[model samples]
Target: MPTHPHSPAKESVVDLLGMLAYGELVAFDRQSIDARLAPDLRRRAQLSIMAAAEMRNYQRLVARITELGADPQEAMEPFVQVIDGFHDSTAPRNWLESLVKVYVGDGIADDFFREVATLLDPVDRDLALEVLHNDDHSEFAIAEIKAAIADNPAVTNRLALWARRLVGEALSQAQRVAAEHDSLTMLIVEGTGDLAKVGELIKRLMQAHSERMTTVGLNN
Candidate 1:
């Protein structure tokens, strides 16, 4: 049977979906690497479990894309360079950095998805919403970030600087993706109903980051 050509609308939708699928794949890989920064076996295992869940979610998204007649790797290729650079450049040096990475990165991801969800149909939108990291992971991140700061108050200046650097690096990579990938950028703009909304989304992410850091005793 011949496959139908998707309309421009649907193609854009698929691209948006693909970008997200690729995001999940890269996130899984990076988090798996950062998990090694955990101080003990228990903490390591917790991070490993979270990383593995990303893989499972990635698989499901890939399967759905295949059903749409898209190549999983190809669909994700556009995002490869930016995401790869983000992870490589921000690679954590210790348990504290790792926790901050997860907290900040995942918080940013959840914000992005919430913005993108409006572009998708019901099922995929719901899937994106559902795949987000849960409260347990958030709680875990808050606890780890707080404990590390408590153990060494001197750690604050270093880790807070690390967090800001991580955010800067992430934004740099994201700007690259938005410039090079029109479809992905358009997805956010249209999906959220306006270009200005992206800034608001970012502000919300910053607010969340501040709350998370304050909860951890880090100066916001």
Candidate 2:
């Protein structure tokens, strides 16, 4: 592992990477499980392929953690309980719910990391952006959701309600993680150069989330 000129920033970067790494790992697991919920073999296979992509992203993050001279598992440990708790509390009961979780829940998280990645140094920023869910994944989810809603408008209200719950839980978990990790908080504050910008950041995330909901024909 090479030494960084800014050790504190390095620690923050490690925290970020660890969180993302665990996220990718869990995404892979969740997608594999949720694929079983798919109504048809085609959708199941498509989801399985997405799960494979997530695993590959996890491997990349783990390799980066190793390059930073940190134990990948150790770096990821701090986030395990929180991430797991979020998933446990928001477990999807059906195929549409699973797709909504993937689209809305995971979409917000990806937006968040993309925003934070801008504050990182060049190499880390690029890696972070590179590992996010691809456009194809988002398009697939949107298409499935829209098709479902179009076929049966009666399901719209229920799915919208589920999306609301997901947003609430995701925000709560994000706050918990930030509050518990001082280095990460400091990184954000320093990067933005103003504590107030953090509030603005949350607003932006929410706005993007709303747009996504609207995109899928769901009410925000």
Candidate 3:
């Protein structure tokens, strides 16, 4: 029997899936830890629930990777360093900072997933859309951040700067991912056949981020 030719594009797809899976896994872990910083039982439980949701999403991604005949662990190993670095550098010091990190970091990740979903094949695209944050959990974060700002007003400046740093760190890691994964880079560029479309996608993510910041009373 003749062996089937492998699609080079599949390499990018697997890489993308692996990265997302690891992200969901780490997100679950970080959110669980951050929940401990919650000031009260109700808030801590809410954060725990949010963290559980990420774990469920992580399982889904892992199953999908397995379905695609890839070892999830091996696939995710490449991303461990950069992803760990992102979380370590952005570790939140307080409950309010934790909320801001969730709001900013997860929001950007969702926006990036949305942008990439357009370039994926049907199976992968659907999976990407499914794994992206549903926005329900974020309501709590948004509410908390807004309430904190209302209470102090001074923390707004601090969190606004924190949000900017989150974006900066995320972008730095993104550039590293792009440089290391050419096939994934090609997927984004070929999505519209114009390099400028990639720039537009990034601008859209930033625009959405700014709106989210303003929604929570934080200056962008």
Candidate 4:
């Protein structure tokens, strides 16, 4: 917004962009790989299309980082470890698990990014919002998960537990990121302006997450 933004604000923007860009890259990779676990050609093709969307978003974000005079790779490097760790720890062991991860994990990720986008300037905020996972893209995964639970209600328990693990791992990585990146953390704290508002934001996110879970016949 300013001709010359404060150093911390600028750095925080770069950091957030970097994190988001890398996240899109990783999302593409995961979606591509997870597509292999799909039960049918149609489902696999759907996931492949979703994966391509993520790559396109990745390009947009990297271009924005370069326009800002930051090296996209360097901007993304600090987050690599934690991001990779999240995927490593939550690798889906089956087709259903992969679907659940895509539905729950990506849903929560988009919600969090949408929340963070509010802290950014108009241009960056729009960019951040653009890269968010589209619920339409997740329709296949959501339908599959819901169908599975409908056919076999007992499946809901296992999937619900898996969903919880995904959320927990995501939150853990977020905490690590906030601790390691001062500027980004400052942006969030300053943007929220108070702990009460921050808690409220969390409540909204959790509520959205719970509704998504319910849609798939899973308990939050």
Candidate 5:
């Protein structure tokens, strides 16, 4: 087998990296907005910290894009519609729902990224891993969800429905992202395939998400 140099991916690689960076940036923005829905200052701050991490990660991705001769904004432009749409359509109806979306949505996305990261070169792989939420931030969201449920048992039904809606919107957005963002999707396709691997990857994401939801006392 011929060993290829780790030159920048053709346009495909460039576009994929751009989409991932933009996705991180938008995720930060949306989470910051949704964080305000938190009931108190502490929880809000925790979410803000998570968003800040994303911005830092975005900077790193942009720097890498520049290194590869791509403009960061140009790299990110193609993904605005699908990313923005998912957040817009899935806007939480309340504090608990917002938490569910943050914890639940972010959890699945991170898992997907972990899978994708493995397929990248060391630098890109490390970048993908670095973009994930820290354990403490995740714990904060989880703790808040548990506390909210504990404090108001009546909220379980409402929050469960809201959680379901968030997942549905998230899955829809993922499909759109996959269809529109070829480079990242190609990474998956290369690792898995057109059919079975993609389905299985999504299944793992869904399963992991379901387990997380259950851990927080939400129904699937």
Candidate 6:
């Protein structure tokens, strides 16, 4: 009998890919809804474009999972509840809040995956980096947020508070996922070669996140 075309992948890779796949899928859904909250048609259309990009990224991740000989849906299943919970808890109330969520929340996630991608095999690392949110989306969100802050200085306090909440919730969810997924945790530990380095990695992620928050005039 012929064997599968690709070699067996590590469990950590599957978990990472699965989590990312589901994340992309949910991002698409959230972006579509967020687009509706856009104050104007141009902004709404921009979000729609970003949402479509998310779906394409999801498809790419699913294809990669299949190539690894795993069921795409099964790979994504484990993360559904965890990811959904994060979204449910962080639901945005208005256009600016929605943009802040996209900028602050999704920015942290992309930063994390980009860091982790360095620890993966070349193919997986490349794919992970490739599927990340494009600069166009980030630029759009940042511009919108800064413009809002400029128009109404009063908006800063509210958005800054919302961003802080997002970071707190995001960190909590990350801890939950790390605690629950042994293979992924092991991958991080092994890649960094020590528990202390893992701590350093997290610090680096948070530091970068703080910079991003500041970039859009939000207090970290």
- For lDDT, the strongest prediction is 2
Q: In candidate 6, residue 92 scores what lDDT?
A: 90
Whole-model lDDT, candidate 5? 0.78
lDDT minimum window of 10 residues, candidate 2: 1-10
Tens digits of per-residue lDDT for model 6, 1-220? 2132232237778988999999999989998998999989999999899889989889989999898888999999989988998888888999999889888766887888788887887788889888888888999999999999899999999999998888888779888999998887887887777899999998998888789988998864
TM-scores for all candidates: the values are 0.89, 0.94, 0.94, 0.93, 0.89, 0.93
The global Cα lDDT (0 to 1) of model 1 is 0.78
Question: How many pairs of residues collide in model 4?
Answer: 0
Clashes of each: 0, 0, 0, 0, 0, 0
Runs with alpha carbons beyond 4 Å of true place in candidate 6: 1-9
lDDT per prediction? 0.78, 0.89, 0.86, 0.85, 0.78, 0.86
Stretch of 10 with least lDDT, candidate 5: 1-10
| Per-model C-alpha RMSD | 3.6, 2.3, 2.9, 2.1, 2.4, 3.5
Best by TM-score: 2
Shift of residue 130 alpha carbon in model 6, Å? 0.5
Candidate 5 lDDT over residue span 82-201, tens digit each = 878888888877777777787877798789779877666677778778878788877877888889889988888888888778778878887887777766676667756466888988
The C-alpha stretches of model 1 lying farther than 4 A from their native spots are 1-8
A best-first ranking of the candidates according to their lDDT comes to 2, 3, 6, 4, 5, 1
Cα misplacement distance, residue 82 of candidate 5 (Å): 0.5
Q: Model 6, residue 76: what's the lDDT?
A: 90
lDDT of 2 by residue, 1-220 (tens): 4344333478888998999899888988988999999999999998899889998889999999999899999999999999998899989999999999999866887888799888887778888788888889889999999999999999999999999999999889989998999998888887776789999999999999999999999974
Q: Write the per-residue lDDT of candidate 3 for residues 1-220, one digit (tens) a residue.
A: 3122222276677888899889989998999999999999999999889889888888888898899888999989999999999999999999998899999978988888888887777777788888877677789899999889889998999999999999999989989988987877887787756789888898999999999998998864
Error of 1 at 220 (Å): 3.8
